[model samples]
Target: MIQFKNLTLRRGVKELILNATLTLNPGSKAGLTGANGAGKSSLFALLMGQLHADQGEALLPPHWVVAHVAQETPALAVSAIDYVLDGDRELRELEARLAEAERDNDGVAIGHLHAELARIDAWSARSRAARLLSGLGFANDAIEREVASFSGGWRMRLNLAQALMCRSDLLLLDEPTNHLDLETVLWLEDWLKGYPGTLLMISHDRDFLDSVCSHIVELANQTLTLYTGNYSQFETLRAEKLARQQGDFERQQRQIAHLESFITRFKAKATKARQAQSRIKALEKLERIAPAHVHSPFDFHFETPESLPNPLLRLDAISAGYGGKPVLDNLSLSIESGSRIGLLGVNGAGKSTLVKLLAGELAPLRGERIEAQMLKVGYFSQHQLETLREDDTPLGHMQRLAPDAREQVLRTFLGGFNFHGDAALGPVGPMSGGEKARLALALIVWTRPNLLLLDEPTNHLDLEMRHALTLALQDFAGALLVVSHDRSLLEATTDTFWLVGDGAAKPFDGDLEDYRQWRLARQAEALRPSSDDTAAPNRKEQKRQEAELRQRMSQQKKPLLARLAKLEKSIELLTTEKAGLEAFMASEEAYADDNRARLADSAKRQGEASAELERLEEEWLALQEEIEALENGYPQQ
Candidate 1:
């Protein structure tokens, strides 16, 4: 168990946590969340024994082995699997001892060392390391490749794999899903759920937290508060507590009203896909969380597009790749005005390439790309952060973007992204990744793009900024095509899902759940046994197997699809009723001096209808995907 008693943690003269007392019992998985610079990492440091509490103690059992992802991995020529195996300190030490004993011809020492190795199951170390690497999205060949050959993101994953290799009593992970794709994120989430240890994770990814964390510990305002349950549960409980206060009542109501109207809809969306599940849950709880930040530091939204052409862009018979090799062949897709789409595929399946083509950063190797003359793209990707002039202040960057605009106007705009006071005027060289990312987005948004192409836009954003961005995108009156691992954002914003793989880009008929099952089936098939003989099977035997499989699948899908249709129809009817009630409630007539009673009744009915609509929609989407999985299988990427 890890415990902090009267913990007064500080950095320099600035107090972070004051007299905070919290205890995490052994095998209890918890999530630590707070605003950026709110001492989440500092608290982690306290537990790791790297930072001493200013006044009290941060304690762990003396014999407990603690594991955390390394912040940096040195450039090493060793195989990635071997590097991961190095995390097991005891294993490495024992092996070193065994080698020395063998060289010294000490029979007794060698026998004892081998016995210890067997007791610890050291023989399976390589296999365990390999599993971790693969789960983190490293292929078998890549696992055997030199560690230094990989990129920075790959190295970070290697570090994570190494941390997971340790059979520790306590595991600490900070932004563990930072560089992961949706598939890898799901694998990691499932893996963490099954981890038999005390886990404390610091993450801005709400869905990941909900999936793996049993409880949440919130750090804010120099206080540490413990909440039992996942992030959503914590938000609701906290909202209820905050609602009791006079200051938060009105704000809470507004948040609740928004949630009441959309919760059921978002909840339905959550069950539709793996990425959406987290975002949908977060959306449900945002009502409660919104009140906590009534005076939230960030408030921003995209400006309405100048012109929205019917087809914003179009690709015909495209063959796109690099170095004269095509990654996507005969790919054709169209982006229309008011479209909200999320691109989905496995890692290295050319999502980035497709985004690049859409943004006009990469030209198609062979094909025609027809763009609307009025098309104005606001593109954002990780590379944009690198392109920011380090010495320039946020204000300076914006000034250059709009040189003719008034300084006050630019300052006001920057403030919307929370670049206020000295922070806005300070040089960006010292800015953190979150700050840099915000600046990049602020610049892109300032352009008033009619077509937004975002690739992992929330990579370094905290939960608050992400929430703000989600709201902004919701109101964005332009076509949006986003590539992101943040489930909440995708679920809340995207109206459609596009599958980009198999050397083609195509509309995916089903939601995230369907894709997830397809991926799982694909993986299972890949791992399934291969035939020893290449001889063709008898036609009758093959035909019989195929027929039986089809019948079994159809039997399972038929009833589920019927339920799905029933739910969808119920949702549609309720949604239409709710929309009418909501519109009437919002009308000036309802809010007029003489119609207060009517307004109350209308609002109540609208809330009820929305809730029912959400419930049905959620059920429909989940069932629809479940049936789709049986009807449509995923091909290997």
Candidate 2:
């Protein structure tokens, strides 16, 4: 158990957590959440013994084994799995003792150490390490490579894997989802749910927190508050508490109403997914925390394009890939003004490749890519971060993007993204990844692109920025194609989904929740032990085969799935309409309005459309079942 009694913590003269008392019971999986500067990280530091409480006591049992992701990963020549195995210090020590005993010709000592190793299941340590790495999105080949060979993001995943490798009584993870794809996020969520430890994690991802956490612990207003249940539960409880305070409820209502407006506009892409509902509920919960962000430094939105061309982009029977090899074959997609699309697939399933193709970074090898002459594309990806000039400031970057824009106007826009004062003018080399990400996004928004090809744009973004991005995406009158792992972002912003698996970009007939189930099923099939007793596939062997199998199955049922997707899209519109009307009715203004004619008409239409939507949805589901059954059929053995 971890307990803090009237704790007051500070960094320098700034008070972080003040006069806070909280208790986390043993084996409690708790999420620590707050604004980026709201002392969440500082509290983790206190728990890790890197910081001291200024008053009272912060206590944990002395015998508790703590595991936390290292902020800095050492560049080592050791194999990544071996480096992860090193996280199990006891296992490493026992192995070392065993080696020494063998060298000394001490048979008795060697026997005892070997038995100890078996007790700890040391023989399968590599396999366990590989699973952790794989669950975090590392490929099997990457697992055996030297640690120093990976890039910063990949290295961060290794660090997370190392932390998970340790068998401990307490586990602390900070933003473990940042470097992950949707596939890995699902895998990690399942793993965390089964972890037998007192877990404390700092994450901006609301969906991840809700999935992994049993309790929500928020640090704000120099206080630590604990609530029962997950992030959604916490928001409800917090909203209720805040609703009683003067100005708090009003502030929350304003923000919620604003969010509801965007959500309504983008409902067609977001309504079917439960995660989007979670966000809507979360935003309604934001009605409780309005005071916290009343003056949030970040308040930027994308500018509407000067020209929104109909059918902003069109691809006809395209074959796209890298180095002359096709990753997407005979793939065709049309992007029109107001298209809100999300791409879903396994890793290396060509999600990014599709984005690159849309951005014209990769030319189609066999198909025609027709772009509207007025199409101004704003492309964002993790790789774009590397393209930013390290020596330039955020303002400098924006100036270069729009040379004709006024300096004061550009500075004001940068300030909206929280790049103000010296920070706005400082060199990018010293900026944090989050800061760099914000700058890259700022530049892209400055371009007023009518078509956006964003690949994992939320990778290094904080909750606030993610929220802003979601809102901006909703308001932008543009064609959007996004590849992201954030469920909240996907559910909130995208209206349609495209599967980038099997080297073909086709409309997917499901939502984010469905995608999670699909991914998990695929992973389970790939990982299941073979029935043949004599020749079981090794973990690495299974992963390699899994990738290949997904690739092989990518092109199957393209036509049927695409048609089903079209039908589902119609259902999406109906569902979105009903959901939006209900959302409006949930507001106080609907009941007021000086008159009730609009409310009556809305209620009448809602009743009319509800049954129609159900019929369309049912038809869509039956079609999906037929396609699935067909895909599953095979010749008798």
Candidate 3:
């Protein structure tokens, strides 16, 4: 458990978080969210003791172990398993000490060593380490692979696995899902949901947060505001709060205007002078709540040209692969103007290969590929940042891309994508992945291409940024082809699904969720028991029973829907109660009543509310899964 009391953090003269008080209870899962550079990672660093607060205290339980996985990974060349196993450094040291004691044949030291070994063994450290490593996507073979050979993305996963292996009482993860593939991310979600340790993570993965976290802590305007429920619920509540604040501000403005008018009219009147003065004083003393500033004013507007009637790119009977191995064999696909297609597949399912083929970066083997005349294609590769000059500043890059543009205009453009002042002047090499992605996007928008090809465009973006990009794509008139694992982004941005599997490309008439459900069902079937026992029913009978179960699952949806609704209501109520309690606790007046009895009462209520919220959330998630299964049974409209 950890607590931050009256904490204030600043960079130079700019305050990041001010007067922030928050508690991370045992087994609590909290999400830190806000716009980019709102100090989400800074808050994590503050908790990790990597950065000290300018004021107040970060309190931790005595001897509580804490581990943090930062956004940027540290350089290491050790094997993945070796790196993860290093998390138990303390236990390793104890083991070494015990070995030395045994060699020395010292009775007292050996006795102490035996007890220490017992204590270390009591935690079942080895089993935990193995489980954590496996859960994070490190297989037996990958565990031995040198980390230096892995890509930056895989290295980040290695870092996460290492952090999780620590088995610390408190874990602080910054963008833990940034590099994870869909399956690994889901595995992590399950792990975190069932984890008994306290967790505070900064993640843009909505599904991950919705599955794992019960509380949302936002860093804004140099302060921390805690919200109940996950990211979606937080968004709903935040919008409502902002609306209420705006209304209150307008009402106050009207009251102040009337008071000013009265004061002006009654200044010389003896009878009304005192009342008018009193009203003036009250108006002057009123604390005006300023409207929240929009983080960036640069609207993202994609100017897509009118769709061409002809097909831009076509692949017929194609076989694509890497290093002499086939990934997609005998595949046929066509891309025409006005098509917004989403590629859905597992990590190694040839989706990226398919994109490369469409981009003309890879030549198809034993097939015909064609490109329409005057095809101006803008390809946003997964490694698009590699196109950027590491030594060049964002502004410099922009200016070079559009040399005729004025300096002020260039700076304004960069700022619109969240690169402001000195930030725009910083080298691209040092920028975060999200910043680089935004810069890449800004550059691409400048080119104004008619055919856009993107691979994982939402990789490093926050929810708002992702949504903004989705909107821009939705409005674009160009033929768009995107390969991404982000379900929501794909569903909202694309009109059709291009599934790259079974050694070919096939068109599916639905969103990514449809693809996901199809995959899940296939996986579930694959995991189902195979006929073996003599007493078991015949294969056809078994198939009939499975079909019946599927039918029953599809038909028995009403009770689950009702249960889902009830759970939603419970979640809403618990969220409201938690928010009220937090607001009350943050008030100065509440400190005056900080006696044992009052504190105990508040703590009891908080605990109850938290427990109830967690339970309801779990039930809600299960109901959602059931609904997803049922929805998969219906034909796509």
lDDT of 1 by residue, 51-121 (tens): 66668888899999999998656658998889999999899999999999999999999999999999899
Q: For each candidate, C-alpha RMSD in Å?
A: 22.1, 20.8, 16.4
Q: Please give, for residues 350-438, the per-residue lDDT of candidate 2 as tens digits.
A: 77778888899887889899999999999997667778887888888888878998999988999999988888898876566678789
Error of 3 at 42 (Å): 1.7
What is each predicted model's overall lDDT from 0 to 1?
0.81, 0.78, 0.72
Locate the minimum summed-lDDT window of 10 residues in model 2: 628-637
TM-score of each: 0.76, 0.70, 0.72
lDDT of 3 by residue, 232-266 (tens): 89988888888888888888888878888999999
| Candidate 3 lowest-lDDT run of ten | 628-637
Ranking by TM-score: 1, 3, 2
lDDT for 30 in candidate 3 is 91
Could you tell me the TM-score of candidate 1? 0.76
TM-score of 2: 0.70
Q: Which candidate, 1 or 2, has the higher TM-score?
A: 1
